[model samples]
Target: MANLRDPVIGPVIRAEGLTKVYRSGPVEVQALRGVDFTAAAGEFVVILGPSGSGKSTFLNILGGLDTASAGRVWFRGLDLTALDDRGLTRYRRDHVGFVFQFYNLVPSLTALENVALVTEIARNPMPPAEALALVGLSARRDHFPAQLSGGEQQRVAIARAIAKRPELLFCDEPTGALDSATGIKVLEALTEVNRATGATTLVITHNAAIREIADRSLRFADGRIAEEVVNPVRKAPTEVSW
Candidate 1:
C-alpha cells in the first residue's frame, strides 16, 4: 500500500469518476454523476445537499456501507473498489468510525458498556471511560439510553464509535433529529473529537449553516457537486445556527 503522508500524495482519501445507479425492473435512477473528491488527513469536510442530491450515496460508498455502480476509491492509496466483501468489512472495522442520525445504543447497556462493546473486539482501543470523557459524557457513563437525553445518547454513540481510535470518521445527518441548541452541542462534541483525535472527518447534512464549521464544504445538486467552498477560518460550533 502507498502512504498517504507522502507529500506527493497527501490525500488520505480520493475518488475518481464516481457514479451510482439504482435499478428496479427496467427503471434506473442515477444517484451520482461522475463525482471526484479528495480529503487530506485530519481535515473536516461537510457535504450539503437537499434530498435526492446523492450526498448520502457518496458517503455510503466511501465509508464502505455501499458500493459504487462505477468508480474507484482510494484510502491511503489502497484501492477500495477492488476490495472483496471481507476486505471491505475489515477496512470498515479497522479504519472507520460512523455516527448516524439515530443513536443505536443498546437499551439495556449503560453508556460505558455500550462503548465497551466496540473496544472488546477492537485490535487496540482506548478505555471506554476515556471515550465518554472525550465526548463530555464522563459523568453519564453509568446511565442507560432511556435515562439520557437524545443528545446525551448520541454522544454515547459517538464515544462508542471513537473508542477504537479509527483513522476516519463519517457522520450522516448527526444533528437532524435535535433542536438547534442540542445540535450545536453535538457539533461541538464532533469538532472536539476531530481536533483531539486528528481523524479525517466527513459530515453530510441538509443544514446549510452547518457548513460554516468545516474546513471545506461541498454543495450537491442533481447528483453532482455544484459548488465547493474553502473556509479561511471555520466558525466555532457555537457560532453556527440553522
Candidate 2:
C-alpha cells in the first residue's frame, strides 16, 4: 500500500501553459487556453467539467493522443514536446494506460486473451490470470465479451489497462455506460487498484458524485481550471454517493 501520509516528492506530470486550437472552417476554436496543471506520483486527481469545457482535450494531450498547439507537457521530467511520433508511441505504451467510456475489447477474444494481447508486448507484465483476478474477474476469465454483463466487460477493460502496470492510469468517463449500481462497482475496482499498486490515476467526469473518491478535484470552465480542491479525507468508492 502507498503511504497516504507521505509528502509528494515530485510531479509525475506537468503541463505548462498548454494550449490547443482547432480550425473549423474559417473559425478558430480554442480547446485549451494556457492550462497549467501538475499531478504528483500516486495521486488520484479528478477533473470535473461539462461538455465543451475542454477537459477531454486536456486529457488527450496529457495521454499523448493529441499535440498541444503551444506550451509543453512533461512526464517524469521528460518534455513530451521533445518526443517525435515514435518516441510518443513508446512513451504511451510504456508509461500510460487509458480507459474510455466504451470497452474496446475485441469481440472475438475472451477476456483473458484481450488482456494478454497487450501484456505480450509489455516489458514486465502481470499474467492474464493475475490481471483478471485483480479486477475480480477471475471466474469470467474465459468468457467472451458477449457473455459478460456491461460491468463485467468494463472490469475486463480495466484489467487489460493495468496488466502492464502502467505508471499512470487515465480514465475518461469510465462509468458513463453503466447503471448506478454497476458504476459503483467499477469505481470500487479503480480505487482498489490505486490503493494496492500506487498508480497515479486521473479521471475526467461530469458526474460530481464520483469526485469524492479522488484525493484532489479540479473544476474546469471555458478551457481553464475554475477551482481546485484537495480532499483531506478521500472516501472509498463504496462509501460514495451514486
Candidate 3:
C-alpha cells in the first residue's frame, strides 16, 4: 500500500542536477555534483556520508541556507534556486525549521523563553508549552540552558524548531554531541514531530545505524549520492542501535 501522505501532499521536496562550486581566490571546489533527489510529505529521510562528502552542502542548498550553482531545487514547487535572498528568507521563516549539532540556546533564557521567542515571530505557531510537551520537556521548560543536560538542551532546540509548526525540517547531525541513549531520545523527539506535523524531514548524520529509523536513506560519496535505500518497514527510534 502506498503511504497515505504521498497522495495528500505529493512531493514537498525535489532536487535535480544540483551542483555547488565554491571558489576561494584561485581554488574551485565542487561540493555537490549533479545530485537528484525527492521526498514526499511526511517522509523521514536520512543522509549518511563522511566529512566533505557533500552532505552538508546539499542540505544547506535544500534548506535554503545556500544556493546551488547549477540545476534547480524546489520545496513544494517554489523554485529555491530562483529565489533571491529576500524570497529565501521569507520561505525559511514561513515554512522551514532547522536543528544543528550544537544547541545554540541563549544562556539567560529558559527553555520556555527560548521557544517562545520563535513563536512570537512565527505566522502560525503552537504555544511554547505545547511544543515543550511534544519533546517531553514540559518540566524542563522553565530551566535555563545551563541547568539542562546535553540531551535536554537539544530537546529544547527541537521544541524551538517545531514551535512554529514548520512544513519542512532539516537536522544536521542533531545527535552528534550526545551519548547513544541521549541521542536516541533526541531522535525520538524528531520522529515524534515529523509524525505529528507531517513535515518532510531530512537528517544528515555520519552514524550508519541511524538509517534504520528512516523511511528512505541516501548514502553520499565524493560529492554525489552513491546509493539509496528504502526501508520496507521503518524501525522506531528506540529500536535503533548506535
Candidate 4:
C-alpha cells in the first residue's frame, strides 16, 4: 500500500489486469475481462455504458462490495484484491462512501438520524447536521424518508455516504430512479459534494447527459472500457439536460 497521505504523487486508485467471474451450477459468466483503470485524487469521473456493460461490477470491486477473481486494485497504497474479507470490510467502513440508485434510508428514522447512523461509527466524521447541510437538506433534517421527494431522499443518502469524509465516493446508477428534473438536482448535489470535499468521485450512469459534469468520461462495453475521454472543461450539473 502507498502512503495515502502522499499528495497526488500517483494514482489514488489503480487497477491492473482485473477480471471477475460468476459461476452458478453449470453456468459461468464473466463480468469484467482484463480491465485496467486508474483514477487520480480529487477527480470527478463518470462511467457511461449500457445495461450489462460491467460498470457496476467495476465500481463494486473498487468500493470493496465485491472481489475480483483476478487482478489487483490499489487504493492509495492498499492492495484491495489482497485484503481478506475482514480487511475489505474495515477498508469500506473507513475510507469509502457509496450511493446507489435507491435512497435506502431507514424509513423509521428521520433524515438526520439516518445520516447519524454512519457518523456515529465513523472514525473522524463530521456532525450529521453538517453533512445534511452539505446537500442542502438542513431544513429537512427531521423529515422521514416517506415524507421527502425522490430527489430529497437521494440527497439524504448522499449526505449519509459523505458524512464520514471518505477518500472515495462511488455512485452506482445514482440517478436511475428519478425523473429528469429531480435527477439534475441529484447530480448537482453530487458535483457540489465532489468540489467541496475533494473526494475522488466516480458515478456510473447510462445517461449521456451526466457526462458533461465529469472531469473524465469512460464508455464501457462487453466488460471493458471501450473509450476514455478527458474533458478540458467540465460543465456544471445545472447545465445538463435530458
Candidate 5:
C-alpha cells in the first residue's frame, strides 16, 4: 500500500486488468472482464449501460465496496487491491463517498441530522448545515425524511455523502426512482456538488440524458467498456432532458 501522503503523478484513480466473479455452488458469473480504467482529479464521469453490463461492479471495485478477483486498483497512488478488509474500510471512510438510488436517510432523523451523522465521524467534515445548503436543502433542514419530497430526500443523501469532503464520490442510479422533473432536480444538486467540491466523481446510471452533464461519458456492454466520449462542452442539468 502506498502512503496516503504520496503524490500521484497521473490519474487520481487507475485500474488495470480488473475482473470480478460471483459463484453459487454450480453457478458462476463474471461481472467485470479485464477492464482498464482511469479518472483524473476532479473529473465528472458518467457511466451508462443496460443492467448487468459491469458499470456498478467497476464502480464498486474502485470505491472499495468490493474487491476485484484479478488485477489491481490504485487511488492517489495507494494500492487498493492489496488492502485487507480493515484497510478497505478505512479507505472508504476517509477517501470515498457514495450515493445510491434509494434515499437511505433515517426516517426518524431530520434532513440536517441525517447529514450530520456522517460529519460526526469524518476526519475533515464541513458543517452539516453547509452541506445541506450545497444541495439547496437548507430551507428544509428541519424536515424529516418522511416530510421531504423524493428529490429533496435524495439531495439530503447527497449532502450526507459529500459532508465528509471525500476525495471521490460515486453515485449509482441516483435518479432512478424519481420522476423526470424530480430527477432533474437531483441531477442539478449532484452537478453542483461536483463543481463545488472538485471530487473525482463517477455517476452510473441507465439514463443517457444524464451524460450531457458529464465531462466524459462511458458506455458499457457485455462486461466491457464499449465506447468513450469526451463532451467538449458539458450542459447544465436544466438543459438536459430525461
Candidate 6:
C-alpha cells in the first residue's frame, strides 16, 4: 500500500465530511454529501467519476472556488471556511495553482507574455522563460498561443500555473479538450511537473485509463467515495493504459 505520509511526509489538504447542496425551485440537490478526503503535500492523486458525480464539485471546494454547506476543510491547520473572501483569494493566489481543460491563453500574447502576466501578480514567481523551459516549451516562448498546437498550448498553461511555485495544483478535466494522443502528452507534462517540483497535485478526470499514473485513485459515485485504490507502482504517463 502507498503510505499516506509519503507525500511531503505531511498532510497539506484535508476535508472532513464535506457537503454541498444547491436549492432549485423547492428541490434540494446535493452535489457532494459528506465526503472525506486528504491529500498530502507532493502527492499525485486522481479523482474519477461520471458526469454530475461530484468530482468537479469536490475539486472546486478544495480549491476555494466554492464553499461547502457543511463539514470542514483544513489546509495545514487553517480552517478554510473561516477565511473571508479576501483571505480566500490570497490563499488561492499565493498557495494554489489551477489548470482547466481549456488553455485560456490570451491570443494577443505570446507564450512568454501569457506566463508573465501571472508572474507579475505573484509574490515571488519564477521567470517566465524558466517556467516555460520546465514545461519543455522554451523553444516556443516567443510564439503566440494561436501559433502553437493543442498539446503545446496546454504545456504553456501548465507552465503558467507552476510559475508561482504553488504548494498545491488542481487540474479539472485537463485532457478533455484533446485527442487520446494529445491527452497523453498533456498528462505526461503534468506528471513531470509533479515529480520535479514535488507539488501536491489533484486531478479530476473521467478517464479511467489515467488512474495508472496516480499514487492514489479515488472513485466517486452519487456524491460519495465509491472506491479508493493505491498503486504500489504508478506507471509513467506513456505506459498507462488509454
lDDT of 3 by residue, 73-175 (tens): 9777578898999989988888889999999999999999999999988988999999999999988888999999999999999999999988889999999
- TM-score per candidate, chains pooled: 0.96, 0.95, 0.96, 0.97, 0.97, 0.95
Model 1, span 1-242: residue lDDT tens: 55433443478889999999999999999999999999988899999999999999999999999999998999886899999999999889888999999999999999999999999888779999999999999899999999999999989989998999888899999999999989998999999999999889999998999999999999999899999999999999999867
Candidate 2 wrong stretches, greater than 4 Å: 1-9
Off by over 4 Å in 6: 1-9
Model 4: per-residue Cα lDDT over 1-242, one tens digit each = 45555576788899999999999999988999999999988999999999988999999999999999999999987999889999999999999999999889999999999999999889889899999999999999999999999999999999999999998999998899999989999999999999999899999999988888999999999999999999999998888878
lDDT of 5 by residue, 155-242 (tens): 9999999999988999999999999999999989988999999888999999998999999999999889999999999999899977
Q: What TM-score does candidate 4 reach?
A: 0.97
Q: What tens digits encode model 2's per-residue C-alpha lDDT throughout 10-128?
A: 88889999999999899999999999999988899999999999999999999999999999998876799888999899888988989999999999999999999989888778898
**Segments of candidate 3 deviating more than 4 angstroms:** 1-9
Q: List the residue pairs that clash in candidate 1.
A: none
Deviation from native of the Cα of residue 137 in model 5, angstroms: 0.7
lDDT score for candidate 3 against the true structure = 0.92
Whole-model lDDT, model 5 = 0.93
The ten-residue window of minimal lDDT in model 5 covers: 1-10
Query: What C-alpha lDDT do the candidate models reach, one value each?
Result: 0.92, 0.90, 0.92, 0.93, 0.93, 0.90
